[model samples]
Target: MNARVEALIEQARGMTSEERVAALDALQELVAPPDQAWGEAWARESEERLDAYLRGDIEGEDFDVVMERMRQEFLVK
Candidate 1:
């Protein structure tokens, strides 16, 4: 890690368990990618599926069919 992050970690290490947990949680969340990014990615994928359907490369229900098949074939009971 870089010097600033190392310093912050050292400061957190000197705190009580609750304080350390709070500081670490704050730092982790600040560095974490947003859930919206995944949502947008899935939206793009859904658009691609719709396009493929329109182009006649696949059927209209292809997305749902693939999902149902995966659920039946791979998902555990």
Candidate 2:
């Protein structure tokens, strides 16, 4: 195994369960994509929604309401 990976495993082995969990969480967040994690998905969905509105595929929609719903649904609050 890689020396660094082995060292990391050894360190983790000494941590309490909670500390190990926190460490793994930090590592996952650190290894996430460079740009905002959901930025691309948000932008793509937004573009699709806008296009649908412009094309009259969606009617009488309250966009801000939907945005609020999305925020709540995504637990951004």
Top-scoring candidate (lDDT): 2
Model 1 clashing residue pairs (backbone): none
TM per model? 0.37, 0.42
List the global CA lDDT of all models: 0.87, 0.89
- What candidate 1 gets wrong by more than 4 Å, as runs, is 33-77
User: Each prediction's Cα RMSD?
Assistant: 10.2, 10.1
Candidate 1 residue-wise lDDT, 1-77, digit = tens? 99998998788778999998887778777999458989899999999999998899996557888899999999999
Best candidate according to TM-score: 2
The 10-residue segment with the lowest total lDDT in model 2: 32-41
Question: After aligning candidate 1 to the native by TM-score, how far in Å is the CA of 20 from where it should be?
Answer: 0.8
Indicate the TM-score of model 2.
Answer: 0.42
TM-score of predicted structure 1: 0.37
